[model samples]
Target: AQSVTQPDIHITVSEGASLELRCNYSYGATPYLFWYVQSPGQGLQLLLKYFSGDTLVQGIKGFEAEFKRSQSSFNLRKPSVHWSDAAEYFCAVEPSNTGKLIFGQGTTLQVKP
Candidate 1:
């Protein structure tokens, strides 16, 4: 079975600063990852995904992720943070295209001025 882990349960970032959310997966083969963000009262929105080809994947809202096969990591990075960016970020993996997604516990982003 495949699983995802978000080491940081919560992260505080200053507004206008850079942000990086860690995501690591445990799988025997190359697995795809999707990053989703959920606002306070909204459904999950797809930020970015990694299927194949380029290791560096670009996402919406000025976000990008790098797929590091050696490290088994697909970390999400934003050059700068915004106050509106504060939300619950989730890292999900689809096991064998089963239509079932294994998601991390989720990381809450708190932005400060």
Candidate 2:
């Protein structure tokens, strides 16, 4: 079984400031990690994902994440924060061959002007 954990339930970042969201996972095999963002009253959108190759993966909206196999972590980062970036971000892992997902509780990002 695989599980994802996001320590912070909420995060606040000033506009133009750098932001990072933490995520940890536990799985028996090489897990497919993903980051998704959901704006208020909107559907989830894929930010970035790590399946293989580069440990660092680039995503939309100036977001990127690095996959650390030893640490069992895939942390998302953004160089600059914008007001529109405020949203609920979820860390999920494809746990089974069926591509079933196990998602973390999610972290809500708050951007301040």
Candidate 3:
């Protein structure tokens, strides 16, 4: 079975400051990893994904993540955040065959200007 855990339930960042959100997974094999963001009262939008190749992947809205096999982690990072970046972030994983995904509880980002 594949699963994900996000230790932090919420995080706060000042505008123009760096940000990082943690993610950890448990799976038998390499899984398809993804990070998604949802604005208030909105659906989720894919930020980035890690299927193969490079460990570090970049996404829209100046977001990036690195997949680390040893730590079973895929943490999201941003050089500088904006107030509009405040939203709920979810980390998900899809096991080999199944299209269904397992998502972490979520991490709410609070951006202060």
Alpha-carbon local distance difference test for all models: 0.94, 0.94, 0.96
User: Which candidate would rank higher by TM-score, 2 or 3?
Assistant: 3
Which ten-residue region of model 1 has the weakest summed lDDT? 92-101
Ranking by TM-score: 3, 1, 2
Ranking by lDDT: 3, 2, 1
Q: How do the predictions measure up, each by TM-score?
A: 0.97, 0.96, 0.97
Model 1, position 91, has a per-residue lDDT of 94
lDDT (0-100) at residue 45 of candidate 2?
Answer: 99
The global Cα lDDT (0 to 1) of model 1 is: 0.94
lDDT winner: 3
Consecutive 10-residue window with the lowest summed lDDT within model 2: 93-102
Predicted candidate 1 versus true structure: per-residue lDDT over 1-113, tens digit per residue: 68899999999999999999999999988877899999999999999999899999999999999999999898999999999999999999887777778999899999999
Local error of candidate 3 at 79, Å? 0.4
Q: Tens digits of per-residue lDDT for model 2 on 57-104?
A: 999999999999999999999999999999999999996556888899
Q: Candidate 3: deviation at residue 99, Å?
A: 1.1
Model 2 residue 11 CA deviation (Å) reads 0.5
* Two-way lDDT contest, 1 vs 3, winner: 3
